[model samples]
Target: MRYFFLLVLLGGLGWCPAQAQAPAARHTFALGPTDFLLDGKPLQMISGELHYPRIPREAWRARLKMAKAMGLNTIGTYVFWNVHEPQPGQYDFTGNNDVAAFVRMAQQEGLWVILRPSPYVCAEWEFGGYPYWLQNVPGLKVRSQEPQYVAAYKRYIEAVGKQLAPLQVGHGGPVLMVQVENEYGSYGSDKQYLALNKKLFEDAGFDGVLYTCDPVADVAKGHLPGLLPAVNGTDKPAEIRRLVRANHDGQGPYYVAEWYPAWFDWWGAPHHTVPAARYTPGLDSVLRAGMSINMYMFHGGTTRAFLNGANYKGDTSHYEPQVSSYDYDAPLDEAGNPTAKFRAFRAVIAKYRPAGAAPLPPVPAAKPSAALPALQLTQYASLLGHLPAPVASPTPLTFEQLKQAYGFVLYRATVPGGRSEVLKINDLRDYAVVLVNGRRVGTLDRRLRQDSLRLALPAGPVQLDILVENLGRINFGAYLLQNNKGITRRVLLGGREVTGWRMYGLPFAQAPTVAAGSPTPAAASGPVLRAATFTLAQPIDTYLDMRQWGKGVVWLNGHNLGRYWAIGPQQTLYVPAEWLRKGTNDIKVLELLRPEQTALRFLDHPILSELSGPQP
Candidate 1:
């Protein structure tokens, strides 16, 4: 073996052979003026992108195996800040969020790691992987050097660095390269910000090669002086070389940091899929020309919980929210199964892998899934019944304003002189279900930009309730500045402003107690919380079919199964067998829209690709 000597050195250093031997630490990774050097030998990153948070903790190794089987020597992943630190200063690296463990797992699987710890990772994830509490940091502007924002950024970097810096190749670990702020060129050309990012990495103990990645057009503006500039895209070799040359005086080791095998999907848009034939030849050309490439998503996993982000270019752009299933139509499906693209790409990678490199391990078998019997969610609880104490406010408060990150917010106003009028919520965020005195009125959707709904107000005193659902924060582009969900502006009724409001914060950070055993008073209110139990003889991965339901979120055994809508592309929720028990398991669904539901079901397969005619 070429790295046999390196294995002896590592073994002498008291490291376990089984975990650290295969991907021999032959050389300290370094960046040359033209190419990357491993123990002074030229190296290229034949990597596949995978996110740790997307895949379940139990499946990390299996996914790594699948990645290696696809002929990748390196695995690239973004460390999501929000997943690690949901709250400011409260970091969580345990369980699925344990990135260090993931890196070690990669090492064990004989793979190198490319760490992209973007405190703000715009992976169509909620708030670009930034903690939602960052919005509450008085006068904070993100992706910039605003003092509060920059301070928070540094702290996060330090925190993540503490966990991962020790695993760098320089420290005898598998991590070869670390990326600076992700796609900074697409956001801004702040040289100082880019330089600060590099400095932070150094200060935090990341001594290996640091690189900055941007789309081909943005490389010049995004790259810093000392850091390597890696272009991202599927551009032709000539164009890619031209772009790199224009940015830096380099003739060798071009790196496509993000080669898009496929694209991400917005809720309303059709599921994106690129034919394998469309890029295999390009892959061959790049490898032949000695360029390193990392597929954006080697395997796109589900966007669990309410972690999906939205997209809005600006005021004029359409507000499109991302669905829960982030199956980016990649080589590996969301379920971690190989696809046609996987087979084709494996063939291409096999052809291009370094001479005499070990043959890839056998492809892993697909995980078994089951179609469960229709589950009857007999128990019920309305959101109004489960709300915490009201935050009495004269005007409606945004989620950030109320120190709330996600879930729903209830804005209730007592209209004394009630009449038939046009009720306008000047800036309604996402989705809102209007209620007049606990009676359903009409629904206002942000996708349709419907802020006002006709109200037939009773002549007497009326309780006007506007329950707003914070779908997700805008993850990318210019609109990220205005990501605060809920009612941003004033509430108007019949051209007259409605004041005196009682706002209820339903972060739903924890699952609420519902009326169990028997149905709760015949389901006569807003946002019913339905409960059901299912028994499994032998637990296996199954999908909770949400076609029969309306819009809501599901919790299996108190674990958030993520948001579901009848306006599907994604009709079923992936319930991992790891989350199931051998006996009985409880399912709780907090459906927001349709309260007329009595039963829920599970399917053997996922329905993530069906486009419902045209989205409203």
Candidate 2:
């Protein structure tokens, strides 16, 4: 392990970056009964949250630049517990997940950083950002005060803090505040855990302000002593007052931790939008009123890979199946372009900027349409071609059984006397199609949490196939980052964990070899790779329409763009310009619900589109 020394912000105004950094100058940032001050001057914060791991690293500067140009003073970001400590002790402080670099970049751009390090960040991320690995850790109950759970959680905090504390204003970094364990009030009423979190942060060398944010409903249970308390659920004057009253009943600066310009959608939920015209002005009113606010995602990027989220409304489980594109229809659209929301926000901020600072820079010139030639992908392999050696007892297996890494996993079994009626996959992880007689007759998605699906069968010896893909691991709260693939448990006919199983690995199917066809159509019903070609003269950011296709995954060249579902809400997959190459680019779509090529085109930007049918 590389030893990291404590970096201190010389005067206490900046972060203590490892590589010689500046610190924030010590001053009383005032929030008196009627006014707020920073360094004894009025302090007004207009913040927006954006995850470092969500957007491609290459685009970080561009996004931050966009935020600054729009007049944002603080950049709020959640440090995913799962991503930082994917496996115990083994930390990954590199690439798109480089939170330290992200903070540094924000500082370089002259913006304050709000680090929302959550062992439980509920950002619509998979399993709430808890790694699947934790599920099997003996008596681990997440988000609790369990010693074992806290041990694991503590390790993550230590690991994450090692990378962050040095970046706090005390260390000469731009980070102004650190948010402890996201939305704790909504998850539980354990104020003790909140205190523990505060201690952990201080132990890690974060001298900047510490805070806890939750919906007002959680204030009594989530607030910490001597720390700033902020509410996340409201934007209006009344709701703000209510949240404040519900908490300390005395507020000078309330942080709108998550001011949603729009909402999220499960597979079948209707797409939603806040209509910039309406919300932009509302946001302005809050700013004009001199409030502290942070948009959950100023630049809602992609959830790429298995990091998408799900909802458990009551007892039913529905995976929202965030498209690769996270364009939450914020001030900035998915394409990194300024929307009317942006222009409106620019106008709003123009009215409140500090007197000495320059006006927001002119919006960057917009790029024109650029086109390129189509490139063909030549090499690939089908899932069936490479089957892992057989396992014992043939019953169904979960992603854990095969010990297979994430992406796609295949489950194979022979019907005793051929096909059986009312065949069902007990708990299909997201999407899976049952293939009997070498043909697909039914598909099931855990997003719908359905079992007992009707299917057709053939006679004599028959093969039953179930191909499952790992949508992005939940990347947010309690279960922050869930990974692993396959059944994880068992498949049942009539509530029996089907046995006599044969499994195959599907990780190699990506960039499949195109034997002798146009690689544009789905191959039968089992998992199939649908490839399409598009040209790009000058690269531009875009979101791919995933609704036309069934449930599965997408790839550009070969990079995973996360999971997709035909279910409504998230319809487009974000394809960042950074991921695009000049000339012919290849696109691959993996449909787990029976193989069929679904023609795909660019949706231009990310926004939840309306569902096709009425709710059940």
Candidate 3:
């Protein structure tokens, strides 16, 4: 006992048993013939997908802890290229976009990682995670074997490799595997392009096992000769396994990379939810068959700012934008609270545990939220009153041509031989508000397939203004090629084309400071900037109810709270308490259709499911 106490004292004084013991052997993770082998032993991966940019930076550890509690040994996440490389050369990995830190946090919570670093990750992210600057490159065709596209892709992958390559499993980190271009077979069947993606990953120092994930039907087309193919879907694991095995010549170890426990919600559509019973049994069946699975989203976070992507199928298609809240009805809700799905999954995972694995960790406590009283917005500034010197152009330019990524663009011109007939805007990308002589006339929406509006022209010369909002860029399908916002072609009025225009590109990249040199708004006519200052005794997270306002964006204390439309579905913008202050907080809204009675309200909860349009 005296010797033991002396040894303990010596250990605290920099002497320890570890120094006397032999070094632990290095563990290697590899793809086995039938299962994932860690140091020549079989391992089963139960993963949950999430994005680092979606959740708050401070809440990353808590979210990972929640995943660990739900029997998730792995966390899958996609590295958004656009968020890291907002500009062509300039890169940012700080704040919420710090993906390395996110991976390290998962490791700290005793979890492994699966990385999906597709430069064109189509996760309903803006432009499918492709940087908008790619559109500016001459003769660049994305997701193809085009030289320009491949060159830019190589540069991006190299940059990512610099930050993450050293964190792979072999380097004493938790990154188990990295995926190539996401579900490429669903988009195209070009083997050469897919091969190039694999080569790029290898060149970027990703030496671990690489895989391609695709829907069951597209597995054959998307699967490469040497790389493993992983399936994605929710139903019929037996058939999906057969399909994946068939693609790999009857391989044994099947992996489902994206098992959708629930779907995502778009604006004007009902929030998506799947019953826990429907998937719990299906998940059990998959595990019983010895196939690894990764839930598409164990916890879906909010798609804040103008980063939400849209979907446009074709010319005769409905243009739908994704809602701000991406609570995909997963095991963990957007607020990181465990649900029925979480408990169901835990039960299923417990039944499928390996021979000697650790017990599931305890669930973390839910984050508390507060509801504040509505604060009235009084000060106002019109968007028209805040136009910078315009870019001169003969023909109307798209958002890409104007070097603008997201938000609104104002096009102004003088009517030639002014006549009040029909005004047609050729291929208006998404939504447009028309005004003649600074007065609200009519709106043309892509959702309703409306491109022409009746213009009552004044005699001699009339000023024409069209404020176009890039609702979102298509994150899926071939429509990604045609995602440029703003008026694509020339505007025609009564068969006479309007020429000689000044374009004001309103990216709103920065926070709203009172639009320079603008008169106070008296009557709401055109798009206006509404401002208000509210006092809070204590800072608390609250949702800003935007039901009273029309289509627009909001910023609170320099933080972009995302877009809001009276278009039902999403009526409240989430404002985090971190963006608020103890004494005073500033709120600004750029409403396209200015309200008669301008005021701002706070809601206790989000209005993500109050659908008013046709059910999707």
Query: By lDDT, who's the top model here?
Result: 1
Q: Measure candidate 1: CA RMSD.
A: 4.9
> Sorted by TM-score, highest first, which candidate order results?
1, 3, 2
TM-score of each: 0.94, 0.85, 0.92
Query: Which regions of candidate 3 fall more than 4 Å away from where they truly are?
Result: 1-26, 416-419, 515-520, 613-616
Error of 2 at 248 (Å): 4.5
The regions of model 1 sitting more than 4 angstroms off are: 1-26, 520-525, 613-616
TM match of model 1 to true structure: 0.94
Reference-based lDDT, residue 601, model 1: 72
**What tens-digit string does per-residue lDDT give for candidate 1 at 152-231?**
88898999999999899888789999999999999999999888888888899998888889997798889887677888
Q: Can you list the residue pairs that collide in candidate 3?
A: none
**Could you give the candidate ranking by lDDT, starting with the highest?**
1, 3, 2
What are the per-residue Cα lDDT tens digits for candidate 2 across 317-390? 35545555567777776657777878877787788887788778878754333222323332333445435665
Q: Any residue pairs clashing in model 1, and if so which?
A: none
